[model samples]
Every structure is written in structure tokens, then in C-alpha cells.
Target: MLEGHPWFQLEVLAASGKSAGNKYRDAANWILEEEMPEEVGNKQVEQIDSKIFENAGIKLIFSALPADVARSVEPELASSGLFVFSNASAFRMAEDVPLLIADINGDHLALVEQQQKSRPGYIVTNPNCSVIGLASGLKPLADNFGLKSVFVTTYQALSGAGYPGVPSMDIMGNIVPYIHDEEEKVEEECDKILGKFTGEAIEPLQLNVIASCARVGVRNGHLESVLVELETDATIDDIKNAFTEYKGNKDEALPTAPEQLIIVTEDESRPQPVFDSYNGSPERARGMAVTVGRLKLRGSKLRFFLLVHNTIRGASGCSIMNAELAKIRGYI
Candidate 1:
């Protein structure tokens, strides 16, 4: 995704792979199943260090580190003037750090300024995979009707657990009901993402979010069933129109931004990883749009099924788009 960006260039490929001293091609096999494109595979894999990034003239970074690793590495890099667009859970709930979905909450980017007052650069974060799916589905509902309560059950993809994840012996044909700390993240992060950013910090939207997360054998997309009770009366057409009409808060077009932020489908069996996972338009925007289907609205109660590409929309793509928004907003 980074290689195809019109504005950003792939500078260095940094990782903790054993092939640290070798080209990215040496570690590509261990990471992705697809053939590594020559675009970035030829870059040397280097150990992640603030000084090394500075020496390489690197100013922007896309971090997909483990939370434990990011907790230590991210601040050091940001302190040294590197914009860290992180996918890790570390610092996501910090008062100053924006748990951002740039299209949903461009206002939250204001927190980056507060962060920069203390340091040369700052970190921006995207929520856990399931939270991304659930939050995307709830944004229009909460905005138009005001959510009184949200209940979600997520059938999350195996890839959300990170590479080499979910041992085959346990997850080959079985669904793991428990994913460590996933439920809590989904329940907590949504309010913050849809929160009101007050220039200094985010005032989390006062709504009760209850979520149950289960890790399924699916490869990529996260499929969630959501039930929301709205604060006002609304018909089915009203709800559907609100969802279809949402253009999001992103003011301008972004290279990685999808043509439609949310695509509402009529097919009952849609949103499956095989068909709807890559629902976003244009080659560059693939997997970046959330696909919602099975909408059933009865008075103030609404139920729907939603899908988001866990790795793309939920992780890397989110951080990439946040950087693009930051660049347009002059925060980068």
C-alpha cells in the first residue's frame, strides 16, 4: 500500500525479523503469502532505532509493532521528530493521543498539536480491528439519531491476531471464543473514536457500548452483527439513507481513501471475506471501505451486519490514511 502512494515514498523497511541484515525479500516469505513486489522487497531490513530513522532522513513512520514493543519504541521516535502513525494499541487511550479514524474524526487531529507542544513529533493511533468495524458502522447512526446503547458481537478474522498467529492445532477448523483483551478494546475504543475532540483532548461520547469478540477462522475481514437503540424515532428508510449518505468528515480526497467511505449492500449474504472484503473503489482504495448489509430497523432499534478488511482498513490502511489527512491538514 505504501509503495503505491502517490505522495509518500517507501524509504526503509525496518523489522525485527531474523533477516535484519538482509534485503526485505529475505523476510517477505515469512510475512506475506503473495509474491513480494520488487518495489520495496529490495530495501535492506534494518533494526528499528530513532537515530537510524533520523540518519536515513526519515520523518514519517507506519508502525505495526506489538504493543509492548511500541510502548518503548514509539515515544523515542516521536521525540526525535518522526511522525509515528501507529497501529499498536499502546498509548491509544492516552488523554493527548488521538485514537483516530481520520474520516470519522478529523477534529481529533487537534490533539496532535498539543502533543507537538511537548515534542517535535507525535503519534496517531487506530483502534483494534473489531473496533474499527464496529465504530465505522455506528458513526452515522450515532450522529444522525444519537445512540442510546450499542451491542455488538464480532466474528473476527484470524489475521487480526497478527502474523504467525492462532496456532493451527487450535484454530484450524475451530473458532476461538476468546482473544486476549479484544472485547475490552472494542467496548472502550469506539466511544473515543466517535468522541468530540475539544482541541486539548477528546470528550468520549456518552454511550454504553457492549461487545463480544470471537476469533474466527476467516482470513481477512471482520464481520460484526450490531444492534443499536437510538435516542430518537426513525424509520427504516431514514436509517438506510443516513448510512448511504454518509460522506464522512474527511474534507478532501486522499490517495488511500475510498470513493465511498461506507457501502451499504442489499444482499443478505454479503460482507463475506470472499466477496465484500475488498469493496472499496479504485485499486489504491481497495479494502478501505466498510460494507454494511442486512439492515433491519424497527422504530428506534436497528440491527445490521458490517464488514471491514481487518488488515487493510483496520490496521495499515487506517494509519496510512491518517497520515494523508495529517499531511493535508498540515500536521505532518
Candidate 2:
């Protein structure tokens, strides 16, 4: 997405280290060292600090640090009055910090006025990857039919595990049935992402999410099998409409926003990872659309298959867009 924004001049900021190690080295090499062939640009190779913030005169900070490291660094950055847009799980559930998905809950930015007590810097963290896909598919349905319960089985991508992730042998042809803390993160983050802040606190939806996660071999997209139960009595048409024309982030003019919120496929065998994973919304909507297939509505239950680009839409891309939205809204 950095490449997509040509109108603005962006400089390379030092990529901080996570508990695991350097996550930005490879990319910085390409963007800073290699991309600029002749001119030797200034590159800082130090840890994140208030010195860098003060020297750089940075107005905003976008952090994709490891969860634990973020637990420590994020509050510090925020204390310095730097607007923080994070993709870490650190402060996602904080009543004051926004658990943002630009398409679903952009209005929640109003609560930042009250977040001063948490830290000098207000933080906006995106929801978990699995939850992002679930929430995108649920938002329109909830607005239309009042979603009550969602049961999902996620075939999460290897990239979601991060750098030097699960060994190739462990996931080559095998599907590990359980991923520690994944189900809980999905369930909780989905509720918060779809929630609204009520002056005093963020009030998450009273929706139930039951998830079963497995480590899959797919390099990018995280595919899920979801079954949603609505509170109201509705027909299959209601469900189809939710996925057919749902366009949540379109009006925002977000550079990375998808044109359609949920993509409904009639091709029975559609939304396959190899083909459909890259479609639905590949650019601004990149990782922004939830591709829904096998729509089956029987009585109160609605079943479908969904896909998401775990890292792009679910991780870095989502964080980047959240920052962009904040910038456009004058928060940074």
C-alpha cells in the first residue's frame, strides 16, 4: 500500500525489534538501501525510544510489534503524545483504546477524547486476523438481521504465525486441530470489533463466537467455515443480500478499503484459496472483503465458507489502513 500512495513523500522509520527479532530488516533493505540506488538515504538502526520520537518529530506511529513487546512499547509511545496505530493484541480490549476495523467501527474515534487517562498517546489497535474476517462478514448481517451466534472453523495461514513460523514439516500436509489462544482471541476480538463505545466503556455485542482453528499450509489467506444464527426470523434472501451488496468501507474513500464488504458467490465451488483468495477486493479492498460461498440457510442457521488474507488484510494491511483512516480523519 505504501507503493499505492504516490502523492505523499514518506521516509523510512527505524523498524523496532520484537521479542523474536528483526521483522523489518528484509523490507528496509529493499525500500531504503536497494530502492534508492544512488542517493544514500539516512537510516536509523536503533531501538524505539522517545529520542527518536522527539528527533524525528513524528506525529504518528504504526506498530506491528510482537504482542508481548507491544505490551511494553505501546504504552510508552502513547505516553509521548504520539498517535499510535497498532496491529498488536496488546491494547485491543482496553475500554479506551479503539479496536478498529475502518469499515466496521470508524465512528468509535470519538472515544479518544476520554482515553487520555490510559496514556498520553491514544492507541488504536486492529482486531485479530481471524476476527477481522468474521467481523467483516458479520457487520452487514448484524445490521440487517441481528447476528446472535457465529461458529467458525478457521484454516489459518502459516504467515499468521509470523517470521520463522511453524516448521514446514509440521504443516506440510498436516492440519493441527488446535492453536493455543486462537479461539479465544477470535471470539473476544470479534465482539469488540463489532462493538460500540458507550461514553464510559466500549460495549461489545452480546454475540457468541465458537471457533476451531488449525494451522494450514496455505502461504497467505486464512480460510474459514462459518455458520451464523440470527436473532430475527429471516429467509435465505436476507442472508444473500447481506453478502451480495454489503459495502462497508466504500464511502470512506479509504485507499485500502474494499468496494464490497462481503462477496457472495453462486458458483457452489467458489472461494478456493488458489483462485478466489486474491479477488473480491485486491487493492484498497485488499484483505478487506470476505468471500462467502456455499450459502445454505435452513431455518435459523446460515452456513458459508469465507477467506481472508491473514497477513495483508488481517495483519499489516489492516494496521496500515487504520493509520491511513486516522490520518484522513485528522487524528494524526
lDDT of 2: 0.76
Misplaced by over 4 Å in model 1 are: 30-34
C-alpha lDDT of candidate 1 relative to the true structure: 0.87
**Candidate 1 structure, TM-score to reference:** 0.97
Clashes of each: 0, 4
Candidate 1 residue pairs in clash (backbone atoms < 3 Å): none
Tens-place lDDT per residue, model 2, 65-170, is 8789899988888888878889889888887888888877887776677777666668889889988888888887888888878999998888788767898888
63: Cα error in model 2, Å: 0.5
Q: How does model 2 score by TM-score? A: 0.88
Tens-place lDDT digits, model 1, residues 90-173 = 999999998988788878988988889999999999888888878888898888989999999989988887778888898888
Q: TM-score for every candidate vs. truth?
A: 0.97, 0.88
